[model samples]
Target: MTLTESSQSLDELLKPRRLFRRLIAVIADLRLAIILLLSIALFSISGTVIEQGESVAFYQQNYPEDPALFGFLSWKWILILGLNHVYSTWWFLSLLVLFGSSLIACTFTRQLPALKVAQRWKFYQEPRQFQKLSLSTELKTESSSSLIAQLEKKGYKIYQENQAIYARKGIIGKIGPIVVHVAIIVILAGSIWGALSGFLAQEMVPSGATFGIKNIIEKGLVAASPLTKNWLVKVNRFWIDYTPDGKVDQFYSDLSVVDKEGAELDHKIIHVNKPLRYDGVTFYQTDWGIAGVAVQINNSPVFLLPMAQLSSKGSSRIWGTWIPTKPDLSEGVSLLAKDLQGTMLVYDKEGNLTSAVRPGIPLEINGVTLKVKDLIGSTGLQIKSDPGIPFVYTGFALLMLGVMMSYVSHSQIWILQANECLYIGGKTNRAQVSFEREFLQIIEEINEAQTPTLSVANEIKN
Candidate 1:
């Protein structure tokens, strides 16, 4: 081959090698990993601070154009940046992918090699090798078997070659970082999978209502499959308990999961913090409101009037409904209720206070006697389908395990027997003082055992 042609081919080969090295350096860089972690944290915090999956009207109302929040953030920016749903954003997913790639690179380039180095046993063949250790000692001994026993008693894996001996403990310390990286990768994979295939929906159903999964607030890109539409939910009943002092104690809803063939699959009494899970979907009771009230007017048939919840903005909850007293639907009394305590405030058409009446109590308004009947309650439920929850939980468990394993100190001891003299040395990745103390204790035992043997040899020589 011509010299110039061969040089060109070599250069072409070197180009890919150099590029590969550069890529590895960038992915394995600790600083890059830290920066990516911090960026992920910052975006996660933003996701928490700013509400997710709200309507455009909600954002427009909260973040107006005239005066934006923090002097910069507005509804337009939120929509454009996909801050309305941060976790499912393409950029966030890409960040997770890059961080995972960094972890893989670091694991392969740093952690595994370190573990292999730790697991390899290298016996000290020469006396001078003892000088290289952080802790070294010299003693007169004919055999290293007793010293090896002492090391083994201290929880070390022993390796012997002729007159040389090598021992180590806590090999898991070297493997811990790799396990941690794997756990983090698993968690990231779970999060990414959830973001891709999970969905969130909300439902406000009155008692005795059967409904399908509708009103999706947020859903993943690939979550609109037929599996989400296969099941049905039924809110059998909803009620609230009141304390003796007229405060709400707890609210509950009886719910059932139904199949496509109208068969009940499961049933549960759902409350706040106590959710029901079935078919990878969880139903949580998030809120409750008054649906309607039944009332009898002047011995007439009982009629149900739907109650509308009034905007309290941060105040107490209140639901109101207008009851027509005249045939023209002009003259009516407004009923306002604050709780399920069976008490309501009645107001005349002129907005004047008429009277307060409880359930089963009679009140005279506009010369007509009204008897309050039962009040129906509605349950606010949040439904979510996340297939990655198990993997995420497992990853966290492994993370804790890795953290514990990392705390163990990997220690190594080498003993070389040269003629009648023994060279002993040791080192540890952590807990230097403790290892030193243990090394000293082993040396003392070796000296005590050898003293009797030396005395017997001296007696024989005499």
Candidate 2:
């Protein structure tokens, strides 16, 4: 073969081999584990620092360009790679999956064996081996059978074939690590599953407004009920009562939930803390907003505002215009009113006037000044739907139960036999100090019981 062709073939063969090796190295590296942990921390901080799911322009406007550093965390690649939304990032998810698998693998390869070793009970009569233990007691006595019988009476199965006694307590003590590791696996799996499959939205449906499915924050991926295609909800009336300190003590909404095509599915009165659930979708009284408002002029009269006006022929058209106080004035205002700033304008039938008004301030028009008498505030609600939430909650409950059980473990001791000399030992799966105290008490009791009473004849002779 020609040298050029041979070199190319060698390069092709080596390239894939190098790539394969690199991939394996990356997967096995401890740094990857550290990276996963750090990423979790980073995401947690990010969630707290920056408002998530904001518009792209918001980040740009807020964080201006800097010559030294990249544009204030602005990277086209970030959006494309889903770094802007780290919760949905494939790499982050992959890290979680890897960590979960590692936990499972570690459980099987390391923890399981350790647990088995801990669970297994072996009769070790060697004093040297017993001396190495964290807690041990050596009792030397002339009669081995009596000592073995004493241990048996104490609820310990003692092996006494050799000169020394062998007994073990709390055989299940070895299984602690296994249970903990497996529980960790279950918890992590539940968390990941919930993150991927759960749907949560906080939509403020205004009173008397029907909401379409897409109007909610979590829209696209939500499934429809088999019986009803779309879950329709209408907020009939929303009431919020706050404490004297302005803290929201309670809130509720009178609502009617319907199926697609306007069929009443259910009626519910949901509150801030109480939610209505049906067909795997939970309807929460999270919030309410201004669908439309009755426009009042100087608090004198109210006018129903139309969203849009349509022509009589059924063609849609919107008609509305802001009327200044002085319609005849030439110019007295800038057209913009946003960001808490109200535009000031001067206008006279054939002349110009100058005046400025903030949103909360009043403006004089014609001859009288009009004030913004009231404002209708919108409500904020949080909604969540997850088929996996139950699993997640169950796992958390189990985790808490296991921790409490391990922390508050109950230990017991039984005295097999007590003769002139006896064997004493107790087993505890948790709180070794407490177990030791209990065992000491038992030993003390046995010693007291074995104490010989001075006979009356011997006492009188003395």
Candidate 3:
């Protein structure tokens, strides 16, 4: 290749490299980082305000088509924008990835380089450098050794070359931003990992029933395998406690984790705000309801009847079931229950109220003697698994530590000895007034020490 062509080729190659450097510089800018942070925060707020991971029908009902919510949002818009599952959406995840990239870029381009500069030691070679300092003083001293001792006593990391000395303190303050960036990266990684691999499922298990996880309401792409092939949980028993006003105070479920061989691995009695955890899975007690009722007819075998939740139109809770009193598919009565207290209201086939009976009560209905058995209750549980929570918490802890460390002032001092004159100057990244006061105190001490030396020299001369 010709020399001119080769030179042109090299310049072209350098152009792209220079462009890339400029881009990195822009991305690492503090203003840019603040803008990106605020943007991420705004999107996160949107995700929280607009419900996530809901059924299509639910969105359609809540955010209708005609009026639309806030005159702009509708079910179609929500589905199209992936608002139903915002955190797991491609755009939202991409935003997080971009923010993490920004953090990395800033850490490498700004924080680490600043720390390196802070760690480096440079001797003051000229008096002009001292003049540039915010706090500088010219003083006469006997030797540099005494000043070195004072600097050491003040906790400065001293570096000496000939008669010039350089000292710095609070270098950790320069390292704090790097730690903060690293912590933010860790938290972002944890959040992405959890969103990609976590699953949320709900189960309404009747007491004394053993089942596997089958009812998955929300799940990520990789979450299905973990849930479908996991352990079995059994509801040992479910009950409720009532207060003085006959209102339910708490509901509890005795749950057990059983292995494939039916051996119990763990057990716990869980209620509201209390949960059972085993093998990375957590089961939370969220609700309770009536599952079924057991009843016996005169001289007949006992039978269990499943109860169905009745629509109350926003007034009260009720569950109902029909029990056949006769064998010819006729002469049946309706049973209604309101709570776990086991009080059941009976009605005839014609919908007329018959009687209210409790458990172990005998009632004569349709010329048949009937005895009420136990009312079975079902435990509503929400199950979830997230492997990244530990990382997230650790990241937050580090973030707080980094913030505290960043508060320390990074201070630097330079000492120059030239032609029987001493020049000293100091500066700090923060707390300017306090640093000024400290510098003045050091000057005062040097003046006091030199005054006695000057007095002795004058007496000897006389």
Candidate 4:
């Protein structure tokens, strides 16, 4: 092989490494990090505005094409962009992972080195070195030991080289930014884990029904199926409580977690805001509806009829069913109930309001004595399992702690004693006025005879 060709080949091999370094540098840049965070925020807001993890028909009905939302967003566009499942989408997770990498890179490449420099102490040997400090001054005072004692009293750690001295306090201030970066990275980890392992489902179970989790609205890429345990949940009873004015106060579901053989393991009476949690799975009561009603005509067996909720614009809910009074099913009456309060409105064959009756009341309709028996109710529940919640909470706590620690000023002072003249200087990350006052006190104590020379405190006497 020719030498020129081999050199070109080697350059090609090294090109990838050079490109990798450039990419890493760009990712570690603060501007890129800000842009990434903003992009994530914008997309998160989109996730909220557009309903997530819903059926295709729901999106189609809600975001139809002819007069699209925002003049452009249709259901097809939403589906194509994966906006319906933003949190679980690959691009969203990629943004999170990339932002976390940036944080880690910045912590190692910038923050750690900066912290190391702040903690390392070196005495200022030359007068020119002390001249560079804004707070430095040449005091014709000889007492350097008194300065060290006063600094120590003010919570500064002292380091000395021959007659030159260095003191610092609040090193935790330097460490705080790094802690913040770590906390953010931990939060990202939790979010990624949750998006990859959590699951959500909804169930509308009738009273006295037993079933395993079947309908999953959304599931992570690696979610553990809730059906793995083969556990069955039975809705022992469902009911609604009403106020004196007949408004629904609350609804409840008596539930039991059982095995395949119907052996009960755990039980709870769940209502709104109160849920049943078992083995990392939680069931929240969300809604309630009438399932059916039972009726009997004189001496005949009780017949169960399924009830369907009617459409209404207000909070008034009503479920209705038609019961045939004649055997040929030619004549019938409609039974409608607004609540489980035993009161119902009976409608005649011509849809006219016939009578208002309650359970156990005999109402003569179509030449028969009909008695209302019972009303069955159903409970709607939302079930979810998120294993990353603990990590997210821990990271949140660390973030708060780190933010508080960052507020502390990392004050540093340098004093060089050359023969009779003592050179003193100091700097701090925050609270400039307070640090200046403290520096003044240290100076005054070091030279009790001569008025201390630092930032002029002449206005103090005024």
Which regions in candidate 3 have their CA more than 4 angstroms from the true location? 227-230, 448-462
What is the clash count for each candidate, in the order shown? 0, 15, 1, 0
Off by over 4 Å in 1: 65-67, 225-227, 312-314, 328-330
Ranking by TM-score: 1, 3, 4, 2
Cα error, residue 213 of model 1, in Å, equals 1.4
Regions of model 2 farther than 4 Å from truth: 1-35, 66-72, 75-83, 140-167, 170-173, 200-204, 216-228, 239-252, 261-263, 269-276, 282-289, 294-383, 408-432, 435-439, 453-462
**Per-residue lDDT of candidate 1, residues 1-462 (tens digit):** 999999999999999999998999899899999999999999999999889988899999998877999999999999999999999999999999999999999999889989988888998899998898999988876688889889889899999888888999999988888889999999999999999889998888999889987788878887765345677888999999888888878899999999888799999998999999988889999889999999898989999999999998777999999998766887779999988878899999889998999999998877788888978889999889887789899999999999999989999998888978999999999989999999999999999998899899999999
Ranked by TM-score, the better of candidates 1 and 3 is: 1
lDDT of each: 0.90, 0.53, 0.87, 0.90
Q: Best TM-score goes to which candidate?
A: 1
Question: Where is the poorest 10-residue window by lDDT in model 3?
Answer: 222-231
Question: Across residues 1-462, which tens digit of lDDT does each residue of candidate 2 receive?
Answer: 999999999999899999966655555455665776687778767656655555577666554454312534654444565655566456766767886665665566665776566544455433444444445453433344544444466555554444434555444444554566566667667656655665556666655667754433432233442223367777666666767755557777777777767788888888867887766677666544333323333545544432222234544222222334443644333222211112323335454445544444666665655543322333445665566667667767766655554454433332222234334444566788876775665555544443433355477789
lDDT of 4 by residue, 116-195 (tens): 99978988888788777758877887767777778888889999889889999999998989989999998999989988
Candidate 3 TM-score over all chains jointly: 0.93
Tens-digit lDDT string for candidate 3 (58-173):
99989998899889999999999888878888888888887888899989887888898898999989989898888898776638776777778888999999888999999988
Clashing pairs in 3: 53-84
